[model samples]
Target: MAPKVLIVLTSQATISSVDKPTGWYLPEFAHPYYKLAGKCDITIASPAGGEAPLDQGSVKMFEGDEECQKFLKEESSLWKKTEKLESFKGKASQFDAIFYVGGHGPMFDLANSAISHDIIREFYESSKVVSAVCHGPAALVNAKLSDGSYLIAGQQVTGFSNTEEDQVGMSKAMPFMLETDLKKNSGSDSLFVAAAEPWGSKVVVSGKNGKLITGQNPASAGPVGEALLQALGA
Candidate 1:
């Protein structure tokens, strides 16, 4: 049977702290979704359960990309109606992996969601892949295991970096810097690595058997998906 994957999206429609509208980054979701489309069984889910908002800025930014445009036109329904995160509680055995898609939106909702934490913990403890990209690692910052250790502690990981956030002029607006936070929770500074340049693709896979995966930015989405597939042996 094909591996079952759960793709988690943020329901936050706006970065209320900055009063800027934001949601899941289109390319982050689209690229990974397309990469795993035929290779795995996928499910779309979110904190709010319906109409997970889209970051309009991303749509315009990637408008020149053919595949991204096609995703917008053909996959509207996927993001329009998402299953609530709560519904997946205790159902970790049903999935081979859990992926978090990023946007500034996740910094507000998924990052602090108790439900999301529980779901992630369950998946990790179940020996299933736990993955996220860009600001998506916000979801991992506080995720802990039963023994009370941060899941990414001492485990190599990467996410939206301080440089990228500054370049985007959202450093001050973000609740906390992803790179710094990830490294802090990782119990060391060296565990988190960023790309050599802003917006460059960087994916990190680390675990006893490479089950914890993360991508550095939107540019790393497809690679992150590929990494997840490889980790799953799919």
Candidate 2:
């Protein structure tokens, strides 16, 4: 039987105070969704159940991406029924792994919700795959493990770097710098990594069998999925 994989997305539809549309990055979810769908049973969820919004920029950025295009054409069934994160009260053992999808929206809600932290912490402590990409790492912020330690502490991590945020000219628009927050909150065991170039692809995996995996930017989305597959023993 294929391992069950849960894909978490941000339901926050708008960028905080920016008046710009924001939600789950399309390719971040799409590429990963496609890559793992065949190898695992996938389910989608969000802070608030129902439909999760899409980032307009991601749609434009991956307009020609084959996997992304398939997602667009199959949008209705592929994405419309995300479960509410609060509803999943079972232990992390319920699934083989969990993935956090990114966008400017996650930087707003996922970063603030204690629910997100608990979910991520449960998965992390259970020795299961706990992965995030780009702004998706926002969900990992402040997530506490059972020993009263931060989840990403002393682990290698990579997310949307500060340089990329500034390059996009949304530094002031976001709640905080993703890379900076990780660096500041990460414990002695954590090593926050950054990509060499703005918008470049970078995936960092830490812990046993790559328990913790993160991707740097939109370009890292697909590769992050690939990494997850390997981590899952595909």
Quick one: best lDDT, which candidate? 1
Report the Cα lDDT for candidate 1. Answer: 0.93
What tens-digit string does per-residue lDDT give for candidate 2 at 145-182? 87888787777888998888898889999878888879
Per-candidate TM equals: 0.98, 0.95
Worst 10 residues of 1 by lDDT: 11-20
Candidates in order have lDDT scores of 0.93, 0.84
Q: CA lDDT of 220 in candidate 1? A: 99
The sequence of per-residue lDDT tens digits that candidate 1 reaches over residues 1-234 is 999999999999987777899999999999998889999999999999999999999999999988899999999999999999999999999999999999998898988899999999999999999999998999998899999999999999999999888998999988888889899999999999888888999999897688999999989999998998899888
Q: Which stretches of candidate 2 lie over 4 Å from their true place?
A: 188-190
Q: lDDT of candidate 2 vs native?
A: 0.84
Deviation from native of the Cα of residue 208 in model 2, angstroms: 3.7
